[model samples]
Target chain A: MQLTQFLSRRRAQKAESRSPLFSFLYSRKIAPYLFVSPFILSVLVLYLYPFYSAIQMSFQRVLPGQVFYVGLENYERVMNPIFFRALQNTSIYVVLTVILLTVLPLMLALILNHRLTRWSNFFRAAIFIPALTSVVVAGTIFRLIFGESDQALANQVLSFIGFSPLDWRYEAWTAMFLMVAMATWRWLGVNVIYFLAALQTVNNDLTEAASMDGANALQRFRHVTLPAIKPIIVFLVTITIINGFRMFEESYVLWESSSPGYIGLTVVRYIYREGIQNNALGFGAAVGIILLAIIFVVSMIQLYLTGAFKKEH
Target chain B: MVHGRQDKLISAGLLAILIGFAFLSLFPVLSLLVASLSPASDLMRYGLAPELFFSSFDLENYRVIFGPEGSRYWTWYLNSIIVSSMLIALSLFFSSMVGYALAMYEFPGKRFIFIMVLLVLMIPFEIMMLPLFQLVITLGLIDTYFGTILPLIVAPVAVFFFRQYSLGLPKEVMEAARVDGCTEYGIFFRIMVPLMLPSFAAMAIFQGLISWNNFLWPLLVLRSNDMLTLPIGLATLLTPYGTNYQLLFAGAMLSIVPIVILFLVFQRYFIAGLMSGSVKG
Candidate 1:
């Protein structure tokens, strides 16, 4: 990014030596830099620098003031079984969340596309309210709602419906379900908006044609509407996958710090605990870099699979 | 059309589900409001209350969140406003700059830069979290507003949004300005900037929300109690009287206010930008 800026500056310099028209006109090139410079400067200071520093620190161990390089040792430790539990949980979540995110939103958008369900604005505003509330607040509310108490709404409903009152967040096997519920609550509406927008592009004639030919609503959706929003679904999938890997706040707030005591943690959150809180700054940085690589690989695979990046257009 | 009653049934079914979802999405806020207002003895475990949902009768919790006793929560809101406003200001600049660069100049590495932006869209704070922490420590920016405001300003998503709006703009207008001998930044500020008012407004709301609503980074970097943002302040509030459901609800609602009002007032721009983000994608 910098090299281009330098080259562009030199180009501007060359143009400045020409006729006044060219010099004065081409000076506009500098504006883009000026326009974008604040961001570049901020990112360089806050984003790029921290990114580089973390890598450097990841190589070196931290002990009080002293720090030194140990290379892949941190990576090795981070990949161990205890931490891999978090990885395993994260992997399952990424897959499940991506699929549900794609399907649920597509279905909701289709059902909502009906003229009878014309309160799109109202439903949208309400459903998206969770997205606005802080995860801390949302998690706390739900944690209280789902707390291990007799009056808990979920357990009350469960018992009312004839099932035993269950420990929602305390178990090993069922914990991811609670996590998924919270994750779903926060994100499902986000995709609903995305799908709703994509739905606007589906020609009404297409769905109408299906109905004219004795097609049912489900059939019309499966054949026509689904195909129109297929690309959007793919986009949502990729986003969901990335978001799943980045899941931290919900787990952090829900688990209240330990996260199965880091067992159900994300690779990113795991790195956070190891690097920042534990003061293994270098090891943490290395973990961060590796996590970056994992994300890069996963997303690349997704893009390649979906063929959404096709150059045919 | 197939069967009138069946159609009605399906329609009602869908409505019921949406209504149910709206309740789930909104019930937490209602509960928060109720819990915040209730007295210490009434801070019950977890039962639905008619008053919480039906009545808008509460002021004690609100007072506590903003009163001298709730100074910490109020400070968090102030910090959040400062940080979010700064972020909004910076993102608008960077986005305009990057957008203009991509729009007018045909740089050789433009494609690569665009690609980087796309890839970075996928690069959530998870990958950058630790590195960011280290970066802050090295720069002595930990606990400072700059640390929180700066990184968020360089958002690729916002940059892309700016670029898209800039593309639809008539190039001839800028060309006309060029003929008049306006400098690069001159045309940008006087010409393209004003023309892109809708984009600016959209960005102001989006960036504002991101800054105001953020919690994780603030939780990580900020140390001093005074430096806390609304979310952090709420967390602090959690500890001293963790048992105070009413107080917790009050603080949460306070945190929710700014973004909610912004979202309401700028509904059109916000929705337009949201729809635009999808179409562009």
Candidate 2:
């Protein structure tokens, strides 16, 4: 029926094409192209060209007005210890953040989603305020709070708890903890919003029936709510991992280009150091390609493991 | 009666937990605000302690920023505003057009174009940063506003969003406009644009926040000190030899004001826009 209607409409359009200027200007065949041309031109020039150039540059030694193909040299340079350290640090950051962001936000959303809860809107808004601040702002505050001085807030808390002050940036564990805490603080509310949206879609009738059938709150949540929001959880985890690998600003703001002993180095930071600051564009492009490969493989494995690709028969 | 009692207990417990987390979330901002208002000397001595709040409060740092000595700060602020405005305007215009066309038309290569968008979405920006920077240099657009905004103008995510949204728009309107002899461009501008107002509002805030807080791209492209955006400028104040706590804290706090105001006025759209990506993905 729709196809027949469309054909009739096409016939009418053809009949109305008596005016050459109107038909030429309003032809459906050409309008879409005109509409899409700007974006297509931009993507081809900015995105596709750069992407192609990045791959090509990765295999060459780029210099001022000159380029020479030195295949595998750039890739082999990426096999150094600092690069591996960055990879390890990024992986750790990704794992910790993905777990915390996924679990804690779901818990928060569940509480907020409770029917008897009061002032839920206020609580939601208050928590989400952190997400509005720039990472630079957040990093500045965290730096102050966790400063090396004994008078810093973190140290004050430490003294209150009977532990001595420790230099946060010097130690690997402390540095990792600070980065993870900052990320969680910044992103928790956004993830909670995601979960809350997904949770609202769950059928209240199903939960009511389960409760009437004598299922406890924990059991109902474990079975019904969890399964219902699995896709969102997978999606958030994938996004968090991607953001995690792309993390440069957080570490950059905290320690700038140089992290103490490279404890807080991230993959993107490594790329920036090699590409922009050091002027080894080829080396940086190589590291970026490797980082891309890591993200792709990890995301695919995660999707497969979570059964995101499996048909729901 | 028993169930009611149990429900009340659970509700109270949950509310208490929610309050604690909310406080945790707001603590950093509160501390920063207080520290921003405090004297720099007190902050330097006590290192952003709660005690400094009681000892003194001063607007000296803010005055410095607004005064002649801090002209560089305002320059960076203005640069950020200009870049963000151009980015939001151009990105919204171009991406929405592409997205609307993809949704409303059944032309050849539509599928291929959409697949290209998806491919772009999967690739992170860092992967292309070096080459893009090189391209900017090659084009002699370095340190220019166009260079900073060019690569991001056709954001893939925004295109995907507008496409998804346009799918839900009624097609009958387009047919009526066509029958009335309205040009296709006229239909989009006169008929469809007003319909997509909510989308425009949502994306405006979303892209505005991104471009305003954006650091890395601007850091690479904008080389002159006077051309620095807020983030990069504020970041440069913190050096190993000596740091400017007053300017750094105050600048950082001030940088968040525009976005915070935007959030307050359009809270619903902000949350909806954020959730839109996750919901569809």
Candidate 3:
């Protein structure tokens, strides 16, 4: 039935070649738009409308039927101490995770790139297996591992090493570190894959030339391999920063909106805490807008630094 | 390329470091697997710690997870499969169509559409969820499966990837098909679709992994027990009062199976797809 309809449609287009209306409607210029209607509808409904609603929500009081315009009140209230604390916590988390994600994965990728890493595929699979697991699952396991009790895996390991067991998430630093550690563990392999892909493009000839010029391995890599893969490094940095800002699941799963001193509260976590959990939809919308603005600025800066906007004259 | 004592030493050091990283990377998975295999008594005693004693190892946890009592677990698993499959299919279709039109055609507002896609890709989905939920509530799709799946069907990342892949497709072939009296839809469906199979495979894996592992939206939209996806369902097991850690760990372990199988089966395409989406325009 569909095939016959399609054929008849095609026949109509061909048969009505001289009709101006049919010709215009069947034109290639218009057909692409018709083909793209689904996406257009999706964007309009899903992306555009929701985005407009978020902006609208940010400016209103957000009470049902009593909704009234509140000019800059949400933004003013968003500058409270708690918001600043959340901001500080998020900044610290992003910086720490970005550094770890950058250096460790680069080092691992460098090591994995070495021909001596036998069964590299197996090693890669083993390393990347965690990436397949959901963050909630990993966070659950990590919570158990880093549990406050003596039976926790982390404390058990500590005891094995002749150290006394301690509550891992009691201290703010340790709790924050636990979340970071989980993020690092889950994403290490993914970053390694990124760097490995970049490493494949690094020409050995340049490194060999550097080595022949009396450079050591480190110097050779510094001058040759790093420059060759600069774009990918920049790309990974962008990805890491974006992901760092969006850190929610690690905290949500571990502490579930009950972290001590707001140590584990990321921007998105705060959004969830206020919007869904606290029933402060308007406040969450304001925070969400702020988060979006911060991400946008940071992304633009990263892109600018990487010369992503530069074009050949 | 020359083998020497210094090279051998460096190679050995590299191998050791890589192995160490790999071990650290696999620690959580290894621990999860070990905990899943241990009997519930031992698991509760040890608290997901890696127990070296083989005497405590058993299939009891798996039995409890897949047993007759674990019908809820099966529902969550089945719900995840259904939602993910629908998302993968619809995402592949609409995203590829948008990508194909953007890459291969000249139309009004093309640049604007492409820019929208790029911007959408950059904006985190978290920010939009609040209002999107409002939209969902207004549309009265709050707990419906279609509500959970609709907003996710046209993923910007998948569309971006398909656009990049389709940009590389030879336009001459499409033009030739057009000249051969094939309708545009027919040409795309029969001709361009086959040519873009690699992109389809790659997007399938990418979208499948994402949809299967998606937690936040599904958690917000899916309110009922049977409606919950795997991540949300498994997470609900960790409530403060008498949390069922045994079933949570076991279910969590089981949740890794489909995506792991997908990654293993399409491991080549997965990496290739990601690289293509990342390394180039």
Which prediction has the highest lDDT against the true structure? Answer: 2
Clashing pairs in 1: A35-B97, A36-B97, A57-A282, A58-A282, A60-A68, A258-A261, B35-B246, B36-B246, B76-B229, B76-B230
| B1-281 per-residue lDDT for model 1 (tens digits) | 66888878878999998888889878777766665665522443443343344555667776665667777666777888888888888778777778767766675567767776665665567666766766677789999998876467677878888888888888887676555555566567767888999998987876776677687788788999889887776665443236645556777766787677767677777666665455563
- Candidate 2: stretches off by over 4 Å: A1-25, B41-46
TM-score of each: 0.88, 0.95, 0.93
Worst 10 residues of 2 chain B by lDDT: B41-50
Total colliding residue pairs, candidate 1:
10
Q: How much lDDT does each candidate structure score? A: 0.72, 0.87, 0.81
**Docking quality band of candidate 1, CAPRI definitions:** acceptable
Per-prediction CA RMSD (Å) = 5.4, 4.1, 2.9
How much is A121 displaced in model 2, in angstroms? 0.9
Candidate 2, residues B5-65, lDDT tens digits: the string is 9999988899899989999999999888887887755564446775765766788888887
lDDT of 2 at B112: 92
TM-score for model 2?
0.95
Which residue pairs show backbone clashes in model 2?
none
Against the true two-chain complex, what DockQ does each candidate achieve?
A: 0.49, 0.55, 0.58
Q: Name the best candidate (by DockQ).
A: 3
